[model samples]
Target: MSLFFKNYKPNTSIYNRQVLWRCNSTTATQNTEDEEEFRVLDILKKRDRQQKRVVRRIEVQPDRTTKMKPDQNWGNVWPGPRSFHPASVPLPLRQGYVPKGQAPPGKYANAELMKIPNFLHLTPPVIKTQCEAIKKFCTEWPKLLNSEEAIEKHYPVEIITSDYCHGSPSIRNPLARIVTLRIKLSSLNLDQHARDKFLRIVGDRYNETTDLVTLTADRCPVRKQNLDYVNYLLTASYHEAWTYEDWETEKTEQDMEYYNWDNNASKRSLVDWYLKVNNDDRSLTEEEYKAFDISVIPHGVEYKDAVYSLMNDGESDATIKNYATAVRKLLGLPVKVDRDV
Candidate 1:
């Protein structure tokens, strides 16, 4: 029957309807069952692959030299005989992948593949359980303390108000747990009493001082002195929050003032430069004359030495003193000159 069906072809001939019907029904049923079984097996294979991902192991050797043998692989993925050498081959029940210096794609997908074993084998079997508890606590507490939400959940009451403390967006209130968790997270030399002092400093900046606790229901204390409060206000303000426009205005004003001074000095120096150039006194140009600011620049700047010596001119002692005072006012300093006492 199989050979006849293999040789059969659907030519344009009307015959054998019953045989064709039986062949089609049997073939469809076999194909459907085969596909279903293949799918089930495929799912089971995937599950097996996932189960082998994070296999951990430890090793023991009788002597240090026996541990150094190179032929034995560390992990289960490599194939070899169960040869009993004294070398440090893995024991029956050490728990993460001891990759043979090379990891597979499927095994590497497990995030815990690189982590240490879930168990430990001790030389003295008595201490193994205690060591495990210590390891578990040391590993897990840090992961909790590193997160702010965990700290707040565990330690709700803070010694200080949480306002003055600031940190990254992920760490909303790091100050609240800064000291409580600091002992676990950081290695500062601070004892519990010192931590209390630090928390007080942080809280007091936000008007959370001891005095604020004494507020009455009916009456509020009116501020007697604005000076201290205003100073506090200024100190509390963040100085670097100036706008771009403010900086631009300041820079522009500075540039204009610098150029004005440069122009004025150039004009004053030109009066001397021209005298040296021409060897004759001549009227100055309109630009040079305009550059000299009369309100700001003094006439004595051109003849400051002559003005100083003229102080000892024959006049009353009060007049001479007034001249000395005027010179000091103009030069922005008192000049020491020899005069009869």
Candidate 2:
């Protein structure tokens, strides 16, 4: 080749093409041998046709409520608290949001109907059955407390509490913890001093119109604890009201919040005036004079009552005028208007 075509060393492009072709052929042969050696046997053999898996869906039976007879016992179907189920209940119930002018969604698949608790189990028949079952455990009412008066007399205290039930994660209610204790002020057997002290201690808790004293306790987290707290408060208040302190004895008439006619100077003066006017020499006690029935005397008991009204109740114009007329009559003084006439 150097002698014939000295300038043309085998063309680089042609030589590359021949070398590439040879490399490609060698690679192909090696790949063919490798593929033949590693070939999976019986791949060409027809495989048994794979059996297709057919899914079968069994039809669900109709709801039991649909086949229920009119005389069927509903209590047996719903025995306790549970979410409302449209299919289990025979009624034609429907519940769900509906656009204006359209009927509500049927209860068949109503989430709205099923989300809330229902009292379907508490039918009249079910209630009667429950009562019959529980009747054996209950005792007869006491004969002594048969009447309302007797019951109130024996059990003066009234306690109020509330119970709540709902479809919530927690059963506890804040209002359930509150306990109210109520009793009539008259039923406490408190004397004037004790009654005054009790009223003062309780402040606005006493309702003057109804004479009811109410105490509420809710500081504790539990209902029982609050109830106990109210009971303790009631006992403490009763005992404290009955206790007499030295400071109370030191309280003078002027220091008294309300007027007392029994110990007033007006009463003593009136008694002395009455005795002097009657010329009764015997020194008689207030109780003895009251027993003497001063109403028989001219303007005697009337004058005393008028004075009491002026003192015990604050002096109103009408009471003051009445007291003046009564005093004039008791003293044998002519009435000013009568004298003028």
lDDT of each: 0.42, 0.84
User: Clashing residue pairs in candidate 1, if any?
Assistant: 55-96, 56-94, 56-95, 56-96
Give the per-residue lDDT of model 1 (tens digit) for 1-341: 99999999885445577778889999999999988884335776678778456867876536543454455323322223332322233433222456687544333234442232222222333355457668866745566577776785565333322234223344344333222101121222333333333334334333322212111111212222232343333333222122124444455423542223223444456455545555857666757565544444453453333333343244666556656765565556866667898
* Model 2 bad stretches (over 4 Å): 1-49, 273-279, 282-341
Candidate 2 lDDT by residue in tens digits, 1-341? 66778665666999899999999999999998987896466743535454557999999999988799899898889999888877788888888778899999888878888777789999999999999999999999998998988988899999999998867788898889999999999899898788888988999999988989999999999999999999999999999999999898999889987666556666666666667876977787767643454555678778878876787666898898888999888778987563453
Residue 168 miss distance in model 1 (angstroms): 19
> What residue pairs clash in candidate 2, if any at all?
none
Best by lDDT: 2
Q: For every model shown, what is its TM-score relative to the native structure?
A: 0.14, 0.73
Query: How good is model 2 by TM-score?
Result: 0.73
Point to the candidate with the largest TM-score. 2
